[model samples]
Target: MDLSFLSEQVLWGISVGQLIVAAVLPLLGFLAQSVVRRLLRRVMSRLRKEGDLSVVDDVNRLLTRPLSFLINVALWNGVIGLLDLPEEPLSIHSWATTLGMVALILVIAYCAFHVVDVFAGIATRAAEKTETKLDDQLVAPVTNTVKLLVALIMVAAILGQFGYSATGLIASLSIGGLAVAFAAKDTLANIFGSIVIFSERPFQIGDIVEISGVEGAVEEVGIRSTRIRQFDQTVSILPNQTFTNVEVRNLSKRESRRVRFEVTLTHEATVAQLEDFLDSIRHSLAQRTDLHPDQSMVRLTKLDTNGLGVLVQAFTISTDFAEFMVTQEEILLRVRRLAEEQELPIMPAKEVRLSGEVGEPRSS
Candidate 1:
């Protein structure tokens, strides 16, 4: 533990310079780091005043720690270079510089990733204001691709620092990628299907769509699959490729919902009663604000053995399911009141025969 022994021991064959410089370099590095941080704070303050707050905040948050480390490394590298060390095959200075360069590359890649994420958030916010969801869906994929590219570049730079060539690595990756594509052809097709979805935009998030006999509201459109929440509250995860293969009906895009059905009445009713019933229905429908004025019809469409089939076809102005149900209920109630007021017989006829006697037909 003697102080004189520390002075006698040489580090990398440097006896006098190692101990003195090690003690002084930390202090100098700290002072230089403090100055740089103060300058950065001032620059960030000015940026906040002139530029976007989010951009400035992101830059300050992502770069602050890496910049501090870089400044400290630079100061130490300069101090270490000043030492009078013996020539060796692998010196401490050379190792420190190499490590420093690699560390710098990693920090740069980290900052680039965060920057991409911030920009993606901004892009998503902008996309939300527009009606189409194509831009919104593209945000994640674009951000991830940018980050991957940045990471690949950083890897190449680091490899180059160690005197390794990235050409062979890239070629090997290309060949490996081809092999993977062949093995996972369906996965690639789904990915391409997602691209087609974003570009074509047949259906978007929250759209009520019917595809392959399944009807639901689109919850999320992901890269490989789309999530749909059914009317029964169950969720269905469909592959993106399914959308490309099948026809998708976007119910939400329909301007109005059609209501069509036949109301059967007893054949005992006279033609005058049938005419009055039809007239009453037309009058009621015309008075309704929910029904489309130009697309309503109430007419006797068929004469069956049991009764007359009165076709009531109309379109409601509302596309909402709940609203459509309410409008249909209102129309039915109005028809019921009209039939009751007019005293029109609405039951179907039945036939009966006597069993014991000579098969006489009778109405039961």
Candidate 2:
């Protein structure tokens, strides 16, 4: 190796030593980043074994790349300061500094963006420990709000770096915010409605509920809309604001379900037969464990030109619709059997009238 020849050779008006140093600076930065990453991996492994890794995992994910970029920029800046290049009309150092600053800001913004996810993960883990699911549902919206805030801050910082006044920009946005609010009123209403859902917890995922005449099981409660899987195998998407404004009946939360209907008998049924029929039906209902004994009733309700109407009203102990329907069918079947056994005909009454003299018909 000829050291004298290497020193004499010039590239970009700099000697071989300055060029070698500039090239080595980036390599050193890369090496430093690798070492830090390896250390972080080891720490993560240890934390995983300890079973308390949420915070550590979040920190590693949010800071790893930004920290590496910061180290690389710092080394490059140090190398640039050490270089003895000729200062011309266009300064290379100034351009390099500006580019470095821009990169730094970008890296910082990226870190800020990912930081929201980390915090959200931490909050979710914390929420899982408690019984209430409202906090769990809140994590997503809170994360989005935090990301938006961080993005705004990053934009402000970038503008400030470029010698623009952020105050003026913010004031301008403030003036335009009213128009934006008017334009996005429904969107904002939905977002607020989601907040209300999380706070109030009118219904939960998988709950059977009736909202705006749509009865179904709740699939997902989202920021903009709620997805409900209907009983007829159809999905209904209602805006979140609808829940806030309209009624929501959570059937799953009910303690008991009422079953009420009128059973008609023929006009030939005597009073004793009807009373016996009611007693038998009431006794059968009392035997069923699903029926609420205290709330059960069977009595003569109305008498019309059709027949005698007996009102049968009872409350089932179960709130499940399927179970309630099955129990109701069983009760009705028992009532039909009782009517057949008692010789009381279960039919609608008919009125016969002769308006004029009967005429003889010819045989065909």
* Residue pairs that clash (backbone atoms under 3 angstroms), model 2: none
Residue 124, candidate 2: alpha-carbon lDDT: 91
Count of clashing residue pairs in every prediction: 0, 0
Once superposed on the true structure, which residue ranges of model 1 sit more than 4 Å away at CA? Answer: 1-10, 13-29, 47-52, 73-98, 152-179, 347-364
Q: Provide the TM-score for each candidate, comma-separated.
A: 0.79, 0.81
| 1-364 per-residue lDDT for model 2 (tens digits) | 6677546648556777777887888898888999999988888888888897676778688868778877877886677666654557677767766666776777777777777788788889998897756567678877887888878887787777678899987687986878887989999899888888887899887789999999999888788888899999899999999977888999889889999888888899998998899989888888889888779999998897778889999999998889999988888888888999999987754568656557955455
| Candidate 2 residue runs with Cα over 4 Å from true position | 1-24, 52-59, 80-88, 129-135, 163-178, 349-364
- Structure candidate 1, residue pairs in collision: none
- Let me know the TM-score candidate 2 reaches against the reference structure: 0.81
State the lDDT at 176 in candidate 2. Answer: 89
- As a whole number from 0 to 100, the lDDT of residue 162 in candidate 2 is 72
Q: Residue 49 deviation, candidate 1, in Å?
A: 5.1
Tens-digit lDDT string for candidate 1 (1-364): 5566545656666656467777788898788778878988888898888967876777776677767766766665565566644447656566767777887788668767777877887898899999987678779877887888998899899999888889977777997878887988988788888998898899888899998888999988878888899999999998889987889899999999988877788888899999989998898888889888978999899897868889888999989999999888887777878888998877644668555566665556
